[model samples]
Target: MSTPDNNWEDHWRETLADHKASPPSTMDWGGMEELLEAKVAPLSPIKAPISSLEGKTLKLPGLPWPVWAIAIALVLALGYWLGSHTALGVSQEMNTIPKKTSLADALTPPADTIFDTLFSVGANGELTEEIISIERAIVNRTTAQKSPEINTSLPAGKSPSPSTPVNLNREKLKAGSNDIAPSTTPAVLLSEAKAPTTSPEFFTGIRRPDTPSSAPGLSYDLSSKPTVRPNRGGYVRPLKTLSPPTDRELLEQRIKALSLSEKLVITPLRYKNGHFPAYRPRN
Candidate 1:
């Protein structure tokens, strides 16, 4: 009896013998030869066309040098004109803006006058007296100049002395006063003239005779002083101290207490033993 290895070797030899005894394939070679000839036939003609194109140079129509120069000059002139126009417009805008006057310049008096010099009066009486004296001097001088009769009436030896008060008739004084133009007074003088109230400092520490000692409904006893409790230094300790569980510990506890139904609900859809839903076509 032959072993199983001898049986396998005999079967392989018979298969090899059958393969060697098979006849050669009868496929046609004429079509393949024709295809190869067609592919090689156009190679020589392609080089001839490529070489002919290399020798000739293509010429494009172009503007003359003078025409190009004229175009560049025109562009430069236009750019220069635009730049100058923009600069001129900017300068005109700047010129149109009114110059701002400084605060000090605006507040300052234009010319030094008598009122400007007398601005340092401490008391209202002195300021008023000085203003009145100046007004009287101006009135007298103006009246005397207009009335040539007053000057003629004075003796030739004495021109009117500035110290001597000119006593003119009341009617003449009134008429001359009307003719005299109103002078511009300082703002300080005008404000003081309108309202001559006493300063707040004048009323300091003075109590009114009719004022009540205390408010109508409110009173406090000053005879006795209230006692203050002493402060304890340290903070008070709480009766109970609680430390809440961490997120990880809580999660572990929750996992330990999970029910079968909850586990099934939490399980991934792919892991669950059920057929997937059928695909539905959209309407």
Candidate 2:
């Protein structure tokens, strides 16, 4: 119960004072194990692990992934088919427009027998929006189609295939060349033509056909000339003259015709400093 550490220095010091050193304590292995076992007790047994959850109704609300995928696929396929069918029909209808005919027949005047035709827009005929739209579409489409046909109808743009050598069907080219340009040039307008003058031979001796006389307020001479007489003074003819450079004396008469502008262009160059001043050549 009372144990102490043994030191040789304490024994030597205490020997002079007549005191004895205590011996070192020793442990017994068997006795210590006996004391430990006496203090401990055995533990209780462990319970079994949980087996199953408490029972209740379970609801798994869901569509399977495969089913959802099939539904989406069906909807997309249906839309594709409907869109393709509609597009095909539209293309066919677009290709079915009537071909162009000669402009003469198309532009011919409608019969005036009908009241609508008589009141219609002049010799140029009536133009509606629908007609112009259809005409422009036809021209644009035909031009695109013509390029391909020209390429195929004869090896157009081919480097003269060595095997076939583009036997340039000359007869076809010559025959078609006739149709290339328009057959008729469109009408150009000259100044309006004067009405034919009455022939003197046709009226040599016959009485004039109720022609108006210069004087008014007189009786008619139906027996011979058949001149028309009305109540008015006779008209007098005035003399007309243009101060322009007239047709005959255009060059000689400079002062009469030349304006300040004309005097500039046609004025003769005068030599001032022997070098004709600084006239820039018409650049």
Candidate 3:
């Protein structure tokens, strides 16, 4: 009933129709829609801003370990150099301080000068003169202190006899001075008077009180009160007790009684020592 073209079309359609169309299930359609939404929709900015920011990582080139180590070492070396230079300057300043000399070094005398002075001939003469002068002074003092009264009592016009200690000492000193040194001179005369000797003439002027001499096997009365000896030193009087005044005598004495207001007034309130009185108010 059809043409050849129509017949061929019908034949192909019939063949294709024999393989039935299989439509998708509800679960599969739902799954397909969820996947499409997840792929197409944009994420919320507030919920994942950190993740969005983290995605763009900076990739800068890091320095090498050796370079860092070299830089640190350079800094340390610079610091050490500066510190050491400062310390060196301080040490140099300390070294410039003047050192003090010791006490022993300052006090020590020059050996050569001392030795020269000691060996000099003039120095020896001076020392001998000094010693002889000292000896003469001593001898003169001894003769003056121990001189006999007879020697002192001689007439001023007459020269002392050669036997007197004063004349003998003076002659000896003159001889020594002449023998030793031309620079030496006689010493001054003594001022103190001569001591009196034990001669009978000295005792004739002085009279001593007679004292009783004790005999052997002689005993004195023990019951008798001893006599008070005369005191050569100053005397002191003994302390004495005095009787107290009786209450009847105190009552008999008159008192200048003050008024009640005067007694109550302070002492500073009273006029005294050219000061005007300042009276205190009564309570």
Best by TM-score: 1
Which runs of model 2 end up more than 4 angstroms from their true locations? 1-61, 99-105, 108-283
Each prediction's Cα lDDT score? 0.36, 0.32, 0.35
Best-first order by TM-score: 1, 2, 3
Q: Candidate 2 lDDT, tens digit per residue, 1-283?
A: 3235657667766787896557543556567778889877665565454424336545655889999899889999999999999999999998897555766445443333121110111112121111112112111111111100111133333332112212222222111122432212011000001111333223222222222111111112223322222222332222223111221132223223322222222223564344556766886
TM-score of each: 0.19, 0.16, 0.16
Candidate 3 TM-score versus the reference: 0.16
Which pairs of residues have clashing backbones in candidate 1?
A: none
User: Per-residue lDDT for 1-283 in model 3, tens only?
Assistant: 6788799888988999897767989998999999988888665557655776676887746999999899899999999999999999999999998655875444443322211101101211212111112112111111111111111334465533212233212222222323423123221111011122333222322111110001111111212221322332322222222112221122123111211212332345446655886767889
Best by lDDT: 1
Question: lDDT tens string, model 1, 1-283?
Answer: 5678699888888888787644543444566667788897655544655677786887755989999899999999999999999999999999999665885454443332233122211112111112112112121121121111111234444533222333332222212223432222222233224321333333232221111111111111111221211122333322222212322233345434432212322445555576655667899
**What ordering of candidates by lDDT runs from best to worst?**
1, 3, 2
The alpha-carbon deviation from the true structure for residue 247 of candidate 1, after best TM-score superposition, in angstroms, is 85
